[model samples]
Target: MELSVVTGCLAGAISQDPEDVIQGGDVLNKQASASMEGFLQANAPPETEVLGGPCEESSWIRPPVDFLKCNWDASIDGRSKKMGMGLVFRDSSGGFRAAAISNIPYITDPEIAESIAARWVVSMCAKLGFQSVVFERDALVVVNSLLSPSPCWRICGGIVEDTRRMLHQFNSWTVKHARRSANQVAYFLAKHALSLVQDIVWRGECPSFL
Candidate 1:
């Protein structure tokens, strides 16, 4: 589907409550804030943890010599109904090639949020004229959905199909699941995006914070 059509579908899917739609943005904001706390609590990391430099003894694996590894993740801000997406690209030698952080409308469902992130990954990579890329995400549902041949009937099915189409445009690509710890860079970037006013893309370097 075209970008405009896909965007329209996404918007329609996100605005499911007629009451919220009629009540105005205030009601939507209240609803988002009420649910967001639970969502974040459910997804929070363990209290005891080792903090180290990026990729230090991390499970994040490198791709083949000629392939680029792209780690992608998404975070949500319920009050604003915004989703932050992050992607970090690295070569086989673990050298950062590029990174991106974007803020977009939040999809309440975690699976949908992940599916959107995957779609964004492929779309951005295609636009950058990349090939032989390896995609890593912490969301196994999304990885399984993408790797499955059977038609997806989930709410995010259309977005998943769009992602598959974009992936086919690449000379080669693979999607796999990674532990959250292994995807810390992308995860942090995603959280940071929640505070960003505009999307940021860095080529040939990574954000100083990372």
Candidate 2:
């Protein structure tokens, strides 16, 4: 399957024809992974920590689920820099809900941040124990890919799937595209995450500080 995907990418890039696109089922389809890898690598944000290490859940501190909004952000590690992703969730009244910020190993490009953000949202949402909530993000590619009919990129597809699993936890939920200005909370959180040199700290009034 990877071979097929890579072929597809090779076809698209090497084509001498101006009006050319990778034909459906073309052997070039195999190149998708290779192309996507390079694309992801080239487009990835700057460098950051490689997450997915063992994480600890703090029962002491807690997020206010009923706070009215939720936001999530993640950074994609580029070769030497990191690209960031931010998401905000707001209730019908448009107040605070929940917010998250995370960083993952560098890949290559910005678009990959979408999937990382998507997966991070799911993981964070689950941890947050949000029963019913709306999801929002600044990455159109992530949102559009989720909404798109074409099968999402298989690797990124897992992030979408994980997001779907988290969605099941919400009695009511929606994913919406939001402008950067509207997603300030999550963006701050993501950017703030970059400040930590040895540990992660949460600001605002989280009960966990208790």
Candidate 3:
């Protein structure tokens, strides 16, 4: 908020440097006044208007009974042009079933990386013999594309087709999107891939970071 006010003031002034416009005393005084106002507003009676927190954070939800839930994520490093895909499988009761991290070389596009993560998770599920599963991801574009297959884009077409084939292999399967907050475990694993020289897999339980 202070930054917004300072920016607004700076926009109307001739000085382009923040140091010249953001006076210490003015900022301090304004901040104190704003804090007091916020405090009173929050502590005000129920009838009074006060700002409240944002909507509740999205959390991981368990899959249906007898089904497995797979949350996958991909991390791409721009500098090295490397991509890492991470996926964690959990039972309907939310117990960890398995997790894997794959570090791929020379992938710069985030969309393709996300698609690979999806395809990789499906392949993992097939090897694990999970007949019924739901694949969850934070990438809405990939999820939408998977739900509605199109031949318009040639990029990752083979990977997309491979994922479709794997999906059909399962008796019951689904692909859906979840907020990044709900997919923290997979995100952590994707970031963790950067430190590994080869793919890593964990069975029955996950690492301490989870």
Task: Please provide, for model 1 over 60-157, each residue's C-alpha lDDT reduced to its tens digit, 9 standing for 90 to 100.
Answer: 78788988988888876665676777788999999988777676765545667778888888877876667778887776676777777788898889
* Alpha-carbon local distance difference test for all models: 0.64, 0.42, 0.62
- How many pairs collide in each candidate, listed in order? 0, 47, 0
TM-score of 1: 0.71
Candidate 3, residues 116-200, lDDT tens digits: the string is 7777787778876787787887777777766664552658887887776667777776777777888887876676554345455
Whole-structure CA lDDT of model 3: 0.62
Which candidate leads in lDDT? Answer: 1
Error of 2 at 53 (Å): 34
In terms of TM-score, which candidate is strongest?
1
Q: Which has the higher lDDT value, candidate number 1 or candidate number 3? A: 1
Q: Ranking by lDDT, best first?
A: 1, 3, 2
Q: List ranges where model 3 is wrong by over 4 Å.
A: 1-57
Q: What are the candidates' C-alpha RMSDs?
A: 13.6, 18.8, 19.5
